[model samples]
Target: MHEMAIAEGVLDIALDYAKQNDAKCIREIGLLIGDMSGVVVDSLTFSFDMIAKGTLAEGAEIKVKHVPLVGRCTKCGKDFRIEHYDFWCPECKDGVLKIVSGREMQVEYLEVD
Candidate 1:
């Protein structure tokens, strides 16, 4: 799955950072997941658990932070967070919307010991 690749990339970055910092082990990994990023949280976690064995992140805690889908209405100057995939403007009920956020998945912070 794509999550496996994403997890591997994240682990690679974390491992490199840990080694550069001379960390003995990783305590936790803080990840920010956007709603539109298409990265399944559960899949990512499963992949992480599977690949983390024998690595510096073994047994490390994973903190996933979900980012809301924030969008700006094209018809009206309104910004809102949407839980559903409907991109319609809440106020105007228009289908035109400009996504402001919720399209990113990145490692925000890493806790190492």
Candidate 2:
């Protein structure tokens, strides 16, 4: 599954940081997942448990921070929360809404010993 790859990548990054910093062990990993990032949180967590085996991040706790999808209206310069596939502007009821945030999946922090 793609989530396995994503989880492996996350561990790879955390290990790289640990190696660079000479950390003996990793306590936790933090991630920021945006609503529009197309990542399944449950799958990611499960894959992390599998792929983190024997790595520096083995037994490390994963913390995910969910970010809401936010869109900016092109016509009226307004911003609004987007639910599902609807991209219309909330303030002006316009169709020219551009995505300003969300659509992100990244490691935000790491707790190490």
Candidate 3:
């Protein structure tokens, strides 16, 4: 699955950082995944576990933070959290919504020792 590639990329970055810092092992990996990022948490975690074998992050804990989708109404200038995938603004009814957030997948930080 695509999660395997994502996991491998994450591992490469983490490993590179750890090596640069002379870390013996990785303790934790903090991830920020947006609702619209399309990265499955369980699948990504499983892939990471599988790929981390015999590496600095072999036993590292993965912490995931989910970011909700937010949008701003173009007509009413109102900002709201999107519950469903509807692009219509709830307050203005006729306004088109511009997505503000929730399309990101990023590694926030890593804990290494």
TM-score of 2: 0.93
Expressed as tens digits, the lDDT of each residue in 1-113 for candidate 1 is 99999999999989999999999999999999998899999899899989999999998888999898899998887999977687788898986788898999999999999
- List TM-score per model, in order: 0.89, 0.93, 0.92
Better of 2 and 3 by TM-score: 2
Q: Write the per-residue lDDT of candidate 3 for residues 1-113, one digit (tens) a residue.
A: 97898899899989999999999999999999889989999999999999999999999999999999999999999998998688888887878888888988889999999
Residue 46 error, candidate 2, Å: 1.3
Off by over 4 Å in 1: none
Q: What is the per-residue lDDT of model 2 for residues 1-113, given as tens digits with 9 covering 90 to 100?
A: 87888898898999999999999889999999989888998999899988888877889999999889999888998888899779888777876878887988899999998
lDDT of 2 at 46: 91
lDDT value, residue 10 of candidate 3: 91
Worst 10-residue lDDT window for candidate 2 reads 88-97
RMSD in angstroms, all models?
1.5, 1.1, 1.2
The candidate with the higher lDDT, 1 or 2, is 1
* Candidate scoring better on lDDT of 2 and 3: 3
